[model samples]
Target: MPQPQPNLTRRGLFGNGLWAAVVAGITGLSAYLFGRTKQAKTVWQIDPDKCVACGNCATYCVLELSAVKCVQVYAMCGYCDLCTGYLDPDPKKLDTGAENELCPTGAIERVFVEDPYFEYNIKEELCIACGKCVKGCEAFGNGSLFLQVRHDRCLRCNECSIAAACPSQAFRRVPADDPYLLKGAKESKPAGESKGIA
Candidate 1:
């Protein structure tokens, strides 16, 4: 003997259709959100041209040690033996002694490259991002030294404290793929040339 089929109700059909619609809407929304999550994000970066070395990076960073550090533009560096950036203004002797160093933490290391040129390397571990070296380099020498945010150390906060405190408004949201704003990289002339001459 064959069994009879259950009755199909309009209410049940409408309820099922509504449930299907809700599921489809939820799925579509989830897909959209997932795709958005994969989209490229912008990270905070300093535009070297706009930066005024205001010393805010040291004071305003949320991290105990600021993510910002001094970087040398080697192409622009004059490589002088008596580097104003490396030595204090009034050093008793042009020596590599800690007392004579401009960096409070002695982060900048002067290495003999050749005859009169010396290569300055920054020890990031010791850097305080105080901008003292950067200021000195920009004012007296080739302006090779500049401050940049170390992405590895940066928290990438939604609202960067250092950025908020920057007086020059140098901080900007740059694409994460190319976040750094390097100095001397774009210039056609050597960085040692005086302004307007280049």
Candidate 2:
């Protein structure tokens, strides 16, 4: 007959039981976390005030068409016929001509609102996010035109390539609920009010 097996002490049993429980808890937590899809709480956006219109948004996005687009703040617009943003510097005439237009893609449309006042409109579908018009507006006009990421076309990538390439650090993550960080009214936006493009 075999000798009686040495019995496990109460302390040994408790310790072993505790260790198993700890291991099981950790494994369960890991599996639960691994199986869940982590929803992003934020999205990439451009800070119009901080942006220098460095032209990175036009080329660095990981999409065939860049999500960045020129948006107009109509309240801030001067509505001059000779819009610096719409026309090349000292163009032969103010009429809509390819050579005279500042936009390479001809995305900006000069609408006849009245005499000596034309409403500049952006052809969003044709825009290439080049920032050429934006730079011109800021430099020579009323600084009403600026760049913003259009969520309608944006992929909302985990890491935005345009943001990384931005020289001005203008790209940043904004709350998903409020994806846009658009410019306020021409005078002010009441100090923290989020605005939208017209």
Candidate 3:
């Protein structure tokens, strides 16, 4: 009888190599497609125009400290010694009395930038997303104080929980390259007129 052909023949080597190459190629394509799809869906955004500043974002957020924060519009600020947003809604005087402050978290820091002009800054660490500052600014000042999503603290979920609970439906998905939807140049008209009014 003829000797059995060697199991490890030239045909076996060629077939095994071809199959390995094909498997690798398929895996590479699958990874590429998965990456592309993931990139397309990675969007996290907040619409300052529609935010009601109701303080829901502070508590409703999934993070321990709400990823949403109140930002300032320095130019629009009247720099009044008595900021309605910063001070108590019904204040006894324009003093730094906690009782007279509107911020539940006391996150807004008011500094005397100059005579008749004060610099208003947000202490993000202290901000609780109550929107008191935004409301105060919108009501009296130029509407400069607005709410934004802090990406570092933000989980960047596929569907943000805050967006779902948003009263005004101000949340949206934006391109990953430019995630933060800053107030545009033309759109910047002080805080009171910018957007996100009650």
Alpha-carbon TM-score of each model against the true structure? 0.75, 0.77, 0.72
Q: For each predicted model, how many residue pairs clash, with residues at least 3 apart or on different chains?
A: 0, 0, 7
Flag regions of model 2 displaced more than 4 Å: 1-40, 185-198
Q: Is candidate 1 or candidate 2 better by lDDT?
A: 1
Task: Kindly list the per-residue Cα lDDT of model 2 for residues 53-86, writing each as its tens digit.
Answer: 8888889999888999999989889998888899
Model 1 bad stretches (over 4 Å) = 1-39, 187-198
Best by TM-score: 2
lDDT of 2: 0.84
Residues 1-198 of candidate 3: C-alpha lDDT, one tens digit per residue? 989678979989999999999999999999988876633544556777777788889888888889988887666667888777788878987777788888887788878878776777899999878787888888887787888887767888766788878888788776556556565443543233122222
Mark the 10 consecutive residues where model 1 has the least summed lDDT: 189-198
Weakest ten-residue segment in model 2 by summed lDDT: 189-198
Task: Highest lDDT: give the candidate number.
Answer: 1
- Sequence-dependent TM-score of model 1: 0.75
Each model's lDDT? 0.85, 0.84, 0.76
Which TM-score value belongs to model 3? Answer: 0.72
